[model samples]
Target: MRSIAIRLQELDDDELEDFVDIWLHNRSALYYRTERLGKTSDKGRDVVGFVTDQLHEGDWDLYQCKRKTRGSKLGVGEALKELGKVFYHHLKGEYATLPRKYVFVSPRGITGPLQTLLLNKEKLRTALVDQWDETCRTGITRNEEVPLSNVIRTVIDAYDFTRITYLTGTLLAKETDAGPALSKVLNLVPDEAPEAEAPETVCEVEMVYLDQLREIYGETSGLAFTTINDVLAHPVHAGHLQLQRTRFFEAAAFDRFHRDNTAPGAMETFKKDIFHTVIEVYRESHPSRLDRVNAVMKHIGMTQVSLLGRMSRPPVRQGMCHHLATDGRLRWTR
Candidate 1:
């Protein structure tokens, strides 16, 4: 397996920030809104996660991204300057409140000096004050030299140093492993299909698909298959009915599992892909409605859809046609 660290090494500064943006979406309960404050003198925020609806005016957490080269790490000089920008902008009223958390994000992480300061809040605060002139003064703004006055000193002294922290490349790579963006950023392995068991009897929700199936059965056999019991009485049709219903339930389970694990609308996006893939086949001439159903089911096996790494299953592919049928997006008879 290729290490995620190697994958992280490939991204540039902007790409790293973009990944951070995608990563933040996983924390929905903690942050109501998340935004990437990209290049353009962004007041020190590379990425922001706003916990409240009040946005920057209220509580927010800021991430300052640094994509360091291989074997190199972020130094205290660059880190302090970023901190200065956050406070300087706050002092200048760019935002009403200070960030609840000030995080330094880098591919290689921070150097020992910065890491030491971060662990000790008092030392971190003292280091910021001491390094203010050398690191932060001229670096914060291109124009004027920011003098560390009493007001600025007061803000620094009062501000919480514990909020300052960092995330190493290795830690970040581990995080991306769990979310939907993992495949987007790095190569993801496919999952195996599970056994899909059908229910003993027909359920209300399966009616739409079963209804379509009944019509196809009646059209082919020339028998009045009016009810679920009527279809169950036929040995041949009953066996086919069980298999089709299993496919439907397998797809339902697939959808439910992905909804819980993958990104928003992941299953829906896959469903749409499957619909477009087989819609042309559904429109084509077939011998009978039952043949049409079988043709669509067969088409899915050969056709490609954007399969989620976790939801890659044979039954899932077959079930999507039934799902589309239930949704009225595809008619097996027509």
Candidate 2:
């Protein structure tokens, strides 16, 4: 069996064309294999393959694969270039006896602009859908008829969205059930009360703390008054010390104090000690430190027990440390 990672990596242009061909031919025997018919003699054709029991008579389809990558497109220019080859082969009576069809397989798909360009062209649009339908049916599933609607539905079903909202309406929609539940669990619901009048611009100590919090975490970390208050009240959090001090202190003084009091490796040692202590305390203390933190967080209006549990987990040597470093909760450069 192919690994998922390998399968994901294998889903490039050629594989996609093969996939489409397999789907179209519906060859249950699975003897289908794609071939490159020589760069020089093949002309425009990139892949040539036969599906068993496609037709009572000798019936086959030829496809020109234009596997576009990022920022690459299959425009009218390229389509016309391939079409010219088809015209050349037709004029030479190469496919006079056999039923022949021309196809352009692009994984990224032909853009709307290019589709319009093809539609506007009299010759290209004339039998495009019929030819494509015939090709797909004969190539992937011998006699089965697969509608365009089915194909569209397949593509639409592949996507998963977290949020859905109307641009023009007051109402909002959520695409996933888990999203709303998780949001509610995290206390992220928007207030339904009447919009308060905009406050006059004024400097405040709370605003300064909010800015500091934003700098420490990030703007979207949702550092509200309740979250900050909870963080300060938590005895385990080192930030609690700074919360007690005034916000107007100089950066130099703060840095000097931090450097002088905390030894070079002391912070890491302290962090480890605190982590172990939390785990030991939880294992030994009555009601447990984990229960205490959860209770405290809940008292401060957080309903997410899962988040608290996650926060209370003992730090392992691997993933969590890396995560902490990546998220700027732990320093690595020092």
Candidate 3:
């Protein structure tokens, strides 16, 4: 799966909220009895869900879900303010039954300062303890007397913000937490190194090839050709020749010879003798007249014009052979 950071960046505001709703739904049983009640009187409350238990007659819990990027921390002030809105809704007869519990959910988790605030705030503290107690009785153990901040941290520690959000939604609908299951499926080790970085720009590979080409041939010679094949075939001014380049030249020569000649059964004989010689020279240079042989063969169309019966050739035939040798350009070589 792609990183949470990457996925979060792709989602818009509404998508993010929907994502949070889904994540909370999947990861926590607390969301099982809750139904998303839509927008609250407070803008801070992105989602309002009513929680009911068998023991309680009506709404037992109220949840305020907040979604943010990983590494971000939500403060106590935000938690308190959200709680106050829930309380306000209760007082105004909006939820006449009045929720017995209040909960805050954040993707990034809550800040340390917020945790302290929750601990100190009498009403908020009671609501959290009560919620924790009820959840514990139902075999859903609260890992700790965690504040809203700690809850956020736990989610972040176990899964990335995006995955946590995704899990929440899955849990809500299925009554199952997908995070732990996903962790097992992924089989990720905590200490493993992250994946290798992707190349930042498109031109990087091309630039590297150009640099290597220039190092083998002179910089001036490297820039003289437009096609990659031309650059590959050019002799390396450097002492050592690349094995890769040598193989390329032989392959290119073999293809060119067959392509230029229209004569039937020409390639069969040519491949046996001339092609064999070309391949040998391409591997290791022979000292005497070997360079001259290569130059001459390249000067004429190596495979195109064989030492055939005729001493005289037509103008167009001569031009075509010459063009094949010089890569379709008039040769200046003496």
Which tens-of-lDDT digit does each residue in 19-110 have in candidate 1? Answer: 78877876777899999986877888889999999998999999888998877899989988888888899989899999999888787778
lDDT of 2: 0.36
**Deviating ranges (above 4 Å) for candidate 2:** 1-40, 49-58, 97-100, 117-334
TM-score of each candidate structure, all chains considered together: 0.80, 0.28, 0.31
Per-candidate Cα lDDT values, in order, are 0.81, 0.36, 0.38
> Could you give candidate 3's per-residue lDDT for residues 104-150 as a string of tens digits?
54545567766555555554444433443233222221243423344
Ranking by TM-score: 1, 3, 2
- 34-129 per-residue lDDT for model 2 (tens digits): 345425555455655544354313444555666556546566555644544443343345543222444565544565666665545444443333
Better of 2 and 3 by lDDT: 3
* Model 1, position 261: C-alpha lDDT score: 45
Residue pairs whose backbone atoms clash in candidate 2:
23-140, 24-139, 24-140, 24-141, 25-139, 25-140, 25-141, 26-140, 26-141
- Candidate 2, residue 83: CA error in Å? 1.2
Best by lDDT: 1
> Listing every candidate in turn, what is its Cα RMSD in Å to the true structure after a full C-alpha superposition?
3.8, 20.9, 23.7
